[model samples]
Target: MATIATVTVPRRTPRRVYLERATYLGAAIGLAILPNADLTPATLGAHAAIAGAAGLGLARAWRKAQNLDASSLKTSMRALPFLSAAAVDGAALYLPGAGWDALIAGGWGVSMALLAPLSRSGRPLRQAVEVLEAIEEPEPEGEPEGGPEDDADEFTRTIRAMWERAALPGDTRLYKVIRHSPDGLDFTALVKAPDGKPVPELKKRDVAAAFGVHAEAVTIIESTGGPGWAEIAVTPDAWEAERDKPQTDADWWAHNIGREQGAAPGSTRTGKAERPGVVHHFAKMDDPSEPVRINMRKLCTAFGADTDEMRVFVTDRGNEFLVSVFDQPPLADTVHATRELITPNREGFFRAGTAFDGRPVNGRLYLPGGAAHALLLGASGSGKTQLVIVYMAADSLDGATVWGAAATEDAKLRLAGAHVDRLGFGTLYMVRLLRTAVALMDIRGRMGQKVGHDWIPGAPDNAYGRLSLYLDEFNAATKCPRYGQEITQLGERISVQGRKYGIGIKVSGQDGKVDDGQTSTMRNQLRLNGRQITLNVGDVSAVRRAFNGLISAEDMPEPLPQEYGGSTLTLQQIADGAEDPEDAQGIGGIGWVVRGGKPVLMRTLYVDLGGDDREQVLADLFPDTIGRLTDEETTGLGPLLDDWYAPDPDAEEGAGESSTGRRRRGGGTKKAAARDRVKTFLDMMPGADLDLVLNAVAEDGLTEADITAAYNELTSE
Candidate 1:
């Protein structure tokens, strides 16, 4: 093969380049000719032209490099020390000054070198222009209509409506939502079927798949405009197919009960081990025809008690029959459990996840030993105070003894114990001991002491193990110079060791660094060992320290104090001698337990102490008075109790006063007992005179003024 010579083509220069060379050369030549002429014009012109040409080339090169997005351009410009030297050299050639003329020329040269890379690219300017254009142009139309929140809201509404329509009474968990863009939203809900498979007809999953979400997310939920819809989880094909086509009556029937009809009727069937109607018989046990009868007392005694096909009503008729006597009816049966049995409104505390009749469940029933101690941290109006009262009242009616205290006077007096004796060692005995120094001292001394042991200094005898001290505005308590130590001790004892015995404490407060003197102690006793609940007090550092990775610094900004009332974080529980943390699925890991008269997804907002005879108690009891007596007090209650109703003596028998004549009775024992019973029943009604007492019992305090304002605000709207 013949050898081929490869020519390396030189880079091009513009035709106008010669003009630049000529301009610099002419100037140098003219300068040399006008001067004393120690140098020739040719040499001067040549040198000047060389420098000017080089500078022009450098600038061009720099611009080009920058245009191509050369990363090193800026660095190269910054690193050019030689530019300064070149500038000095160029200056010296025109005006000679010792060795400085050479320095001037060198400086001029260096400046040219630095400018070289600038010519490589104009990328920054182009990028800035592109950004401006993008901002000026309108966004492309026909994107997704709603955001994640809108979708979530819609999804929630859908599921909520479906549940309501199905007439399934229980808690409905919004577990998760899986989305496929341009299709629709899909979500999952969990229901409890204690006895068998939950009744499927009670819950329907309707959705739209065109938008990449389930039609149920849109059709069934409450839409507050836009894409606020909740999507329930269901088969995508069914959802998509139904998007354009309307379902006929036959289709609707098939869609609603097809699965049920296909299922085998007995427990012996493989795919139909659980009958839909049998799953939630307990939640509606009151229906007269219930195939089963479960003792409420027995059911409340343990966490998990069998109440399955063990014989419950299979029909809605007002009759009773054993489960063994029951048989599967026709496939199209539409039986509903009656309201008489297992009504959600009955007295009891139910965990969040439990369910009844294919519905999520909530209600509180006292199991004697199910009491829990909690600490709440948040700023004022965070709803922490209300949460504490709600827990206490609900638990108290369930046979729990509640004792509550708060810094404010109104709070203490309102929630004070109705009958300290009724509060005994196991009843809810809310004590308003936040007033005097002695009371503070008494509580402090009793902080770490167990309830069954000897009374601590300042504490009353028989109050041990019988009290659940609810301290509201804990920061105020801890801030008091005289009472702060007691407060600290209280935190230590309750948070670190209070769970073993029946006694418990729920403390609420604002946030700030704990006093250095108490920080370590609080850490070991309160924060480290206690289950911490933070309500929207978004102090990142404080939260990080209090909860570590359970919550991150980023989440703090989202739960600021201004966002209080709705959000709360519960840290792990640390019992004495325990090694591991609780594993609740949510952030705080403490799944919310609702305690109320009905199905509530909220964290047991407030307890209904069933509005018991608050009016009678309010009219009857006063400080230093015989206090409202129960019906049982009338019998064998002698002269010492007489003054209780002295002014109305013979009003009724057995209406007696206390040892001090300062205390008085209402009437004779017989009449008094009757009145007491009536008062108790009345108290169970709404808006009783003992409203303050009820509020305090239910929420540890009765700030009536605040309550009045809240009531007016709610009613006015």
Candidate 2:
């Protein structure tokens, strides 16, 4: 009412808009009149020509203006309604009745009226043209003043820089910031590749580096929404918060007792009459005058109601108490039952000890129908050597040949009385033992081929019985300057291929990394196919390296303290030389074993045969009968052993050899000489088999062992 004068809003009309409207109108009129006026071919022909002309004009207008793509599926589908109407008119030409013709005429008129651009205000044509014209125009360059980049925080910029530095495929853009706090940042992102390429993986380390944080601080996981999408989180302060929030006594008791919340200390004491043997005593933290005693039965029910026995003791630090629940008193916990668990079970798995929950800790010498290499990793005083002896004893009891090697003099002395078929005591001996194992593996492989099957336990025809090679201080042996390469090569061969031939390898190392030399390949193979036992270590990294990330640092076993202080003997009694507690000496059998592809906490069996004498204890646990190899099985191994035992000819004439004997430096030269001799013999006896060559070389003072070694060396070359 305020504006008396009319204000006109200008509408921009497309080029040839009038011509397009006229063409459609003319075509509609022709089709409507043709159905009513004529049954002649000329009238129908005229109608068809008009419709064709209209379609041609509309297509040209669209192309010239660049408003729409003529070949697009959208454009073709839009023409369906008009085409359907035309088909009905064409059918009317062949119909005999006038009723059908009239009906077709009406349908054609209605379709054309709706489709035709009758005016600038016609909705169908006007809306379509506007949309197409908008699409044809190019979008304005550059983002608006308050665009995404301008609004993004420092964390977002850092993420963008990280993607660039990592050289990840695609253009990653932040979709939304879910959170941004001093503690962390959480966000979702979209990755778009050029020309529809796939998005590349986002590694955690790359993201961490971008934010100047640790790898564990950042987490990058692909979104489940679809491809080319990911969810990222960066938390620098989360670790500190978790570390500071220590678990309280109430929290620990609640978790252990399988309760949502801990019961009030004094409240539970009143219900002792209803729950007999449940409540013992309780005291408030603020009241020091009150007596303090914990209910044993209530704690026992946390493990299970049927629990009959429990052992409670304080840690060496006096900071916490540990309660071990057991259904039956663990036999391995006492020295009196030492022999009960050392024996191998029916399936050939040795009962090493019991877990904290009193489950049997069983490990096998060989995997029966699979690979049976074992890795024992722990720090010194972690009972690793004791566990190794248990495994050796189990194998010996099963009639398996046990070959032992120690990297140090002390280790050698400890294993001296074990049921070893062959024992090597020092670095040189360890290397020689490895080489012999490799040669034996090759021989057994060949023997298996001739027998037409893999080695089976207790087979009558299988002369090469089960052989278990135990390596103590393996990390030290691998670091030897003269024989490290050869040792690594031999270890790898046995780890990869020895299992099928009834050959098993067990390695014990103080350092779980084994990074001192070329033992990485061999270590990887063992981790993949062997059972791994990691005892209390000095640090978390040792366990991580041993299992190759199969176990995380959070799950690593707690390191054993240097001193075991929970002794029953009083200070005056200790001065009297009564002796320290037995648990103190074997304080740390506690460790982890990989069971069912997961780490399980366990304590190895206590071997207390000789009281405090370590050597006597080992010797007592070992079997009385030692398994030995037959002459036939030790054919090529004899010469290798002879060379190992032989003194170094290069040593000074008056100097005495060490207890472990001098290493043979000229063994390589002798091996080269043997290879040459075998080559010369083979050149004369071409196409000859191993047996033929052995017989032919007999006159030359060459034993079958020499021939076999020489032939193997030459063939390998």
Candidate 3:
């Protein structure tokens, strides 16, 4: 994140444009007057010296002001000789008859605005547009050779090959695949008699030959979808013989689709009503021997649970019929806990548990290479609150101080080992808590500098060992007139730079969109921190906000049904506020985890707040921490801040970066003061721009030119 006003073209403004024009004009004028200094070797040497100094000053200053990246800076440095050469070319072509040479010969033709190259205008900030695409896209498994991205593309190809094989001249083509996965393929295509002809029933040996599986592993669904179409579930013999099979949510849904879809207008079947392709989305078999025309729009609509919210259906023409539904039931088959998750390691890594595909997930979010924070977007009853509780419990048990901020005044949690001194809820206390945290962060930074530490959380000297802030119902709080500004500022600071100070944040909200008037930088930084946990938001908008437009309609998480007349409400209804939150209790604990730089569907442990197993469930989750936060002494913090607040009415609201956001400079001593300055500026402008930062820098008595010089010297290399 370097300032690279002059080196690249990512960020641009009127000032940068003016500076560029001035630069060309300045060079043009110098070229227009050069050779008349006797046209001698002495003059040539002086000219080269002047050009070198000018190039270094201008390049370094612009780089510092605009925060150019290293690559761009290197490019500009390589062009330095060209700049001098261009001036020489201009001097070589200048007409001495024009009298511009006569003035230079008399040593009186020096231009006054030539000094303009030294002004802050000459060093105008460069627009740092990130042209570099992300080099890494995280995916689960099977990629030591080519990687998961290649695997995904290959998976799409597999679908094409499967359909072609199924459409073979003699093989059975009576199944439409609804779900595809490495484990099994869920097919919806029926096997009824064709017109007046009798349908050939699948034989065990024939099935084995067609599917490339053993005769013993071939299984058929004789219960649902009338006579023509039957659900076929194929698994390895090893997997089937196990006592506890790897039954997933997709498996659960597939096993129950018969009951949900009502046996597809039944025939004389006598088995339990189970749909043929409930787990169609998880299917991954290839037996096609003929071509299949895949109609994605129609198939997706038919396959999806909610029609109104289901954007697309199944379509296939070789490689175009798949939907990446990492959020739905079959994908995020089940949920586990911190015990099954959060594997504490000496390397300071934690295995966060499985993604939708049943692959292990580990996220070191607070660590240097991690995203620094986790952003959650879930509608009410979408498991946002519960997940927050789990995260807090995990960190608390791992010896991190957890600071919580909620919109309610009387928030109570059954956290087992939480320290009460860190809990702050409601608007006022939340503000005080954040401000105090900011102050603490500032002080700790100075302490870390003294101890020669960069990011050693939980170190003995670091009193606030790995502080994790969990802000529930973040959007609702952001709408507050007075506190909205502060919350936004605190959050932005912690997210953008907190990785180095043992601080991290997890912000959850009903919708993922930023407030209407939020600045671009804040929004970008918010999205930039990609460790997102998106639950069943039940809306296309929330999906886009969380996944960044990389998902499909059928891929959307199926809305959790309402208690009574559950099918009557749609996810859009819940997202648009038409459906009651109480009614839309969210479909289980299914969600997506976009940590490790990739989106993977995941589910948290099953939790029903009103169920009788609540206590036992909590106990199971945190045997050591459950009910451990009973008294002040055990909790470590003094007491719950049920009543604590202070208001600064005169404080300007909506300022993004405050003086409290410490900006690193030349020395360790200035760290606290820099943070205070950042806090002060943010108090004035919620998300301060370059103008605001420069203004604050000036106000602090650090003159712009001197600041520029220092910054250039520090960052130029």
Point to the candidate with the largest TM-score.
2
The most accurate candidate by lDDT is 2
lDDT of 1: 0.35
lDDT of all predictions: 0.35, 0.57, 0.47
Q: C-alpha displacement of 572 in model 3, angstroms?
A: 30
| 1-717: candidate 1 lDDT, tens digit per residue | 111112333334322333333444444333333333356787567556646755765666576676655445554443342343334444555675455543444444344443433333222323464366336432222322222212244444454444444444332323233333323434343332212222232333322322234434333432222222223344445455674488663344233322222211111111212364343221222333433223322332221222221222222222321121113211112221121222223323332222212233333322233224455665544445434444444444333445455555443235435633222111011122221111222332344354554323223442333344566655566555333543555455444444433344555555534562234544444433333455434455654443443333322222332211122133343334444443212211111211221111122232222257543432232222322222322221222222221232322444333343111444424333334323422323323233322222221132444444444443355
Per-model TM against the reference? 0.27, 0.46, 0.42
Global Cα lDDT for candidate 3: 0.47
Worst 10 residues of 3 by lDDT: 1-10
Write down the RMSD of all candidates, one decimal each: 28.8, 21.7, 36.9
> How do all the candidates rank in terms of TM-score, highest first?
2, 3, 1
For candidate 2, lDDT tens digit of each residue in 1-717?
A: 010112232333444455555555565555555666745788767667646755765575555445555334344444543555466557766787777766666666565555443333222444575466336432123211221233355555555555555565466554454444543444434443332344567777766665566565566766653454456776656634543578764434434432322222321211111122222222132234323233545654554432222232111112122344333333235322255566776666778767644578778765557447888877877777777777877777777888888787654335444457777667777766766666566566667787787776556787468888888887777666555544666677778778887888888888777664536767776777667788877665565666666654434443444433234566699899897656533445767776645466667876553446866666566667888776765664445545454553233433322343333433534454345445644543344457544533332233567778988776666
Clashes of each: 140, 0, 88
The residue-by-residue lDDT of candidate 3 on 1-717, one tens digit each, is 111011121222334445644655655556555654467887687577766765775666566657667645554544543454444544554654636544432322123123332232223243242112112222112212221112233333343345345453333343333333444442223343333333456665554454455454556666243343334554443434432577655443343321223211111112222233233232211333333233333434445544332222232333222333322334324555645565455444555546544566554445434325667667766666676666666665566667777766423343422432355567656665555445444555555676677556445664335667777666667556656665666666666666566777777677667563233455565555535667777655556665654344434443333321124457688788784444322354556665433345565654444666666666665535322222322232222222444444224343232354322332423433344444443443443344434433332334555544433433344
Poorly placed runs, candidate 1 (over 4 Å): 1-371, 410-466, 516-532, 538-557, 560-717
